[model samples]
Target chain A: MALTLDQRSASRRESRRPAGPRPVRGGQSPLARRQRRIFGPFLAIPLALYLVLFIGPTLYSIYAAFTNWDGINTPTWRGTDNFTALFDDPLFIESFWNTLLILVVVGIGIFVLAFSFMLLLRDMKGKGFVRGVIFLPHIVSPIVLAIFWGFLLRHDGLLNALIVKFGGEPVAWIGPDSAFLMIMIAMVWISTGFYVAILMAGVDRIPGYFYEDASLAGASAWQKLRHITLPLSWDVIGVAAVLWTISSVKVFEFIYAFGASQGQMPPAYEWNAAVFVYGVTFGGATPQYRFGYACASALVMLLLVTGMVALLRRAMRRDAVQF
Target chain B: MTRTGRLRRSISFAALGLSALLAVSACGSPSGPGDSAASGEFTYWSMWQEKEPQAQVIKAAIDSFTKDTGIKVDVQWHGREVMKKLTPSLRTKAAADLVDQSMNQLGNGLSNTGQSADLTSVYNLEVPGEGKKVSDVIPSKYVDYLKDKEGKPFMVPYEVTGEGLWFNAKQLPTEQPQTWDDLVKLLDAAKAKGVSPLALDADNTGVAKYWPLLTLIRAVGPEGMQKLASDRTGAAWDDPNVLDAVTRVEKLVKGGYFAPGYNSGQYPAQQNLWAQNKAAYILQGSWVTSETKTYAAQGFEYSSVQLPPINGGTDAVGVNFFGFGIPKTAANGEAAGKFIAYFLNKSRLEGISTKADNITPRADIPAPAALESLSKSFQEKAVYPSGAALGLKFGGWESTAFQPVAQSLVQGKTSAADFVSQVKAKSIEFWKTQG
Candidate 1:
């Protein structure tokens, strides 16, 4: 079946030519037309659902923010009064500051720990087992973790018991000054492992040959990380940052469970934005049902987080680094 | 397939989809649980968890009502955290016919907002199979706590409650302290024994802050406490009696009477520590008996003494009855009222004290031996009803203004004078929001 060079060249030339479009597939079969018609309604169902369930309530909350709706009665329009009251209230101010503190402080702490862990774990032995052990807290219910944390820090708790055994005075680890600090630390502990796992996944995707090439070029660990790992994993790190920002603002169970023994609501000083919303609406010995006021506070948090996320995406944007 | 066959199949599918949508939309519509006109059946929301001894007793009484009326009853055990659930549910179609809640909770509940029914008729209704009406058996003081803003009865009183200094009889001095100075002396002596004088959970601002509040009640009569609470001029807080009360709270905080780390400690932890005889005393309500039943140290008998009168002020102890209220939205309001009357019968209410180990609101029903000492002493001790029950101008003023500041005072972050000014300022703000 050996071909002459001229015949082979003729066949290659014919293949290189662009072919004309084939006759329109059976001129659009009736079945195909039916499928196209059905596809729209199926898509519309979910779209309509999303509009009703999510978007509808979100819009309603915006309207409610400017009114005084006690859940049981007609809501009176009170333009900007709720916002004024919320700002004037010391409790709301404390909660706002605490939420921001957790967002920034705990966020930085988690990112640093996770990034470091991901780096160390990249070349470490038994990384799988170590990752699993650390990520265990994310799987456990937060209320359970809060209980164990509260138990460890209480006056006659396990930590104090151990301290007393060594002839040391018990520490007031759960005191008002330290309670929020412990919560922040616990949040960092619970959140870091999940972020690390995400980061490591991103790091693992880079071709081994890139690292080999860098090593041959005499790249140090820090240089390899700075020039190679950081650029490649920027997208995932951005996603993780956004995720942490949203979740850290919504933290309720850990702090709420810390005050479970007190009653329905925690001490006002320990409250954050989420707790504040719940307290104003459904929490505490009496339900204030300040849905309007709570909605105003909620809108503030929503706007803040949304603005931060936008800024973060801008900061993290880079041209895709193709392998 | 044939075109006609495809058309029929598509039509059937469309019909099925339409039917499903109809069913779902119908279910979404709120048809509030039908209120029973003739009382065939009803629902009750009891604010006790399933395992609590109180829940069992409440269930027994409910069962008796069901048997007598032949009306099926559904009970949802919501526990003590029921307020968070009950308040919202009151506005919904699924509102229960009856909800058992604390009388003090009335100050902060749907009852406060006039969402609850006027059960004054229930108070007038005769206890089933009993010769006397509801008012005849229950103490007037308990009934007094049941009044609404307009002086109408909105809730029925059942289980009685009192807050006083609870101490383990075996651990503390046999004789009661006669004055505030003497009380400090006793605390100092207890501290010398390597025991903290008080086991307090400042984190539990509701119950723990009552230590200072009840002292105020003792220093200033209930009238004076009310005057200070309602006064907008800020002069009431400057009253020497009010200063004496704040000083009383300040001394305890600064003196380290409470166990170490108490301001940060969780409740039940401190309460339990007190039960284990780790501290000399704790400020708690009568229900502490049932609350600490599991953690009880063997031979630990609970004894309480009213806070002694200070500066010749009235020697009143804080006492209010805990009971159920029928929401205006109840599906079976009439039946709910009847159930309240039946539940408060002399025979039925005795179980409250016997099985539940709580004080019964009925004067005829004596407290169980565990609380007999306090019950006997309460006859001699003047009762200072909570300001809320007495129609105070504000709801949760104690929780919002008094407690947080009391915490600051205790932590030495604020002095007695500063506490007064801060509270007065808070009161002004709170009053501005009241309307």
Candidate 2:
């Protein structure tokens, strides 16, 4: 048989190719092939875990938000009633604002303080030791810290006892008027160390030569921080802000431990969204178990976190400064 | 691919398959209550912490039960956290065959939600070798408190509790205050002696409002408290009797009778203050002794009294209680029932009273001396359910409406009329959503 031009080319290409096994592009080498073999289920296991653990509960919660289920009874559909009721609820409104305040006010306080500490520690002696001490609260259980804080501020507690011993009248440091403020301050104390560590790591990655050059140029410390440090560490700050936003919304244990002496829940004035959700459900002297309503509150919190994170990403976005 | 590569891939695939199989197997079947007849073992969850005297007594009873019945029970002590865990656990296959917890441990107790077995049959069961039915031993009044909406007793009554004004025998008179005015004078006399006349668990939203609500319920009658909750018109709270109760409570708080920091003091802190005689009295439940036992001053003695009648209205008393229930999911329901019957038998309950420092629900068991003084008031002509007892309406009200307003009232941030108006408005809003 006479060979055509296409047949002649195919023969040429085939003869040029190495024999034994066919070559495949895009993750088809022997090692890649081995990886591929395990990859499906290696990926599958975690993906399945994520689906089952996180996504499944999230979806169920969303469905429950529209119903009228006490934790014990069969749920009944209540449509948007739970949402409508929540909007009208003063407690929910207070909790929402409280959450927002923690996110915005507390968030700002933490970032500024963290940045300053990071800058100070960047050039300071024995920075590692200082960091370990400051980060101690972060590593220690928040419940323990809160208990210590309470012991310090309680009526006959250490602080008040000291004041009285000094011939000063006892002050209600953790009274109703000042308790929320104390909580905010305690939160800042607890979380600032974590953020400082994150910010410091980001700042540390920048070459020390940049600061030397700035000093050579007579650029003030503030100017250097404003122009060089912040812009360079922008990505870490963005991530930190989003993390704080998410975590502050879920702030329960620290505040809840404050109420351990109070019974199932703290006073309403001290409650934030997380405590509110718990209070409406099982965390009360009498169990309300308003599961559907609590789900609605939780969904609102989820939306708040999602929205804040998205906004933070947008607001903090900048061109990557290649070092 | 190379032979080794192919072999590695096969091994990886096999490993992944094995892990997945192991994971699925690890999930296992949800554990049901054990077959007591076949395996001779059952499970129980107790709400009391093990160190508590009540837990010790129960443990002794369980030991007795095992020795007599030859059925082993596994008991888990979860304490106050039991309520948070009970509902979800009941839905699972790993549910315990029996649970010992507060009567109001679940939402309105096991009877309201039908979560536990209808223990009415347990009431008919004879206590082992005691020759008495459970009903014959436990008081009918206490049983009445345990009834569900269907008039069935879901809890086997254990500890009976009451809420009243408690005073230190060393500091204050144990005699009843003759009238509301006389009570004010007595409070003043205590103040003159450098002790605050009252202490409050005001930092607790649920507990802070108990004094005001219970007094109002008694002053206006149960019907009045019901109207305050149910009446959408908001006029129910405006009843003169309600106002009188609210005003007098306001006077007590505003009169500087309470400890200086009472409005802001946390639960059990104010209680401890009373224990140390910093305050002359505390409006507390029967468990106050156990709660403050550690804080007790040397030679400290406790006695309780009913609140004096307001405006010569009928004298009423407030009582709260705790007991135990068995979940409906229990596999060994018969064995669990027998255990409950044995636990509540008269002799066993008396031991509970003496050893646990509680008011056992069995009438045959006399109250300890600390509570004996208040027994007459508890048995008074008009029996009033404290807000705690009205679990259905009181829970949401205390959390949402009453406590916050009461906080303001005690702080002098809001007036009695404002308290009434706020409660009415909140009640209307609360009931509207409840439907």
Candidate 3:
């Protein structure tokens, strides 16, 4: 059947007589078959791993969320009880709110700082060195950064020590009201470098002539950015936003390591969704072992992230600038 | 189609199947050593790192245990996460024959799951090379405290930990306060003398609850505290005693008795301040001396005192035990029990006090000087498990509900009334999810 279709297509092509090269028979050439042979194993191995390692556990977790399992016993079905209970759970609500704040507030802080740096670095001397220096935090282990952040912000930490040395009263940098705010600021500082690199890559791809032309036309820096740089980097910005949304929900170790005291959880107020999940399950002086509840919380986070990313993509969608 | 094309297609199918098989096999649970009973050896998972002082003591005891019985033992130093890691292993044959962790951890990880073996027999087992049994060494009160809800012993205590107001003996009055008001007067005097009265790591939600819990336990009793924790409707916070306790904490907060930034900094920071003589007292576990010894003030002398009594209240002290448990599926339960008795021997257990700088269940063994006062309290006074071990059983009620409200109260962020109401609301909210 394929041979007959191929012959008919070849005869049609012969009638038109416009092609420079003939199509392969049945759309399977020797090179194509060889490529499939060589690449098929490479793709299949990771695909199998992803399905087994990621998808399998994800599906099991989703099932577990609807049950009452304490990570040791048989899970009994509880339908939507776990999900319904979550709304009334003050800890869960607070953590979810914290997660959202990190997504929106920290996200904005990171982007604003990153875009400003990207623009400034575009014309600066030793741009590479400055970029490298800014990117250093991104490459450093988050646990290490959290330790450094703690040392700088804690009540007798280096920052306060310096203030006292200079004849000033030591400020309560990590006071109850200010703890989460400091954490958000640290998140912004640690993440701005990565987004700067991404935006810079996108901005660098735009031809310099566009900016030169805009300059000739008496365009201000803001006007040039609005017309050229932003539109050109719109897709990259959308991706970065989505990345930050997902990562913000999973920001566990930094807050946990920095805020947690004596191997116990930080105060419930500082908890984001990831910390909430751990706090409810395996992460405390006395592990709660609330597997089903944690899985439900995790599922809620996943759904919220999925919806957020969908909305972000819809909002970011625009006609591509062909530049 | 050509020969190479068909050959390539076949190869691709083969590769896909091979990869799929590899993935499926990788998902299977790993098998451990065979039946320990037949081998006459037991697998023990320890809660301490091999290099830790506690582990070194336990290791020496294990070596002697093996030599005495001529029975081989396989021990793994699983560290502090042993209990958390032991949960999954309990479902499989990979589970250890013996495991050790705090009683609270055992209650949450083993007893609650019904995976802990009844340890009454172990308690009755005679200690090797010693005249007495395990129960003879450990006091009856602790043995009763270690029992499960079903009244079966599930853990054997080796080390004892008590929570109280830790202080530097050189800086603070050595005399224990007789009443809450008297303690307040003492704190005021200390403050007047230029030492901060109290140091708290409010960032640690777990430890932050110490002040309120102690006050509540003093105002009400341990049973009353348990009632407050287990109350699903949250009305227990309305108990006048709870309000009184909360008000006491508020007074301390308003009195400016806590160290500067006491409500904000991470742990050890505040505790370290207390160690450095900048603060007069820190409410902490008995381990505070060993934990802060490195940075302690140049002549710092560690000491502790139980919470001052309230009129018409029980004087039960809060105690936690570090002990050993046997899994229900353990093949070498008998041998594991023997080891427990052997380790409890006075000579062997002395290492916990002398070398590890901790208190032991055997009161006959002199406790580390810093813990001597607490050790006396543990033996002489009425004692109960801290928090009633309800923090784990009630779906993390302490961490989720009590801790945040207590933090707000102790930090002076919330009024006593507000603190009571918030705790009530949080308690109700917490129980709603437990359903």
Rank list by DockQ: 3, 2, 1
Each candidate's B-chain TM-score, in sequence, is 0.85, 0.86, 0.90
Better of 1 and 3 by TM-score: 3
C-alpha DockQ of every model: 0.24, 0.32, 0.50
- Tell me the native contact fraction for each prediction: 0.35, 0.40, 0.72
Q: Is candidate 1 or candidate 3 better by lDDT?
A: 3
Cα lDDT of model 2 by residue, A23-68, tens digit: 6743257788888879987998999899989999889899999998
True contacts kept of 1: 0.35
Best by lDDT, which number? 3
Q: List, residue by residue over B226-324, the lDDT tens digit for candidate 2.
A: 667667667787778787888898888767777977755556678888898888888877678777888989888878877776665656666556776
Model 2 docking category: acceptable
Minimum summed lDDT over a 10-residue window in model 3 chain B is located at B28-37
Q: What does the lDDT come to for candidate 2?
A: 0.77
Query: What is the Cα-based TM-score of model 3?
Result: 0.90
Clashes of each: 0, 0, 0
Q: Which candidate comes out best when scored by TM-score? A: 3
Which residue pairs clash within candidate 3?
none
* Predicted chain A of candidate 3: TM-score: 0.88
User: What would the per-residue lDDT of candidate 1 be over residues A7-94, giving only the tens digit for each residue?
Assistant: 6766886666566874344357778988987998899899989998999989989999999886666678989888877776667788
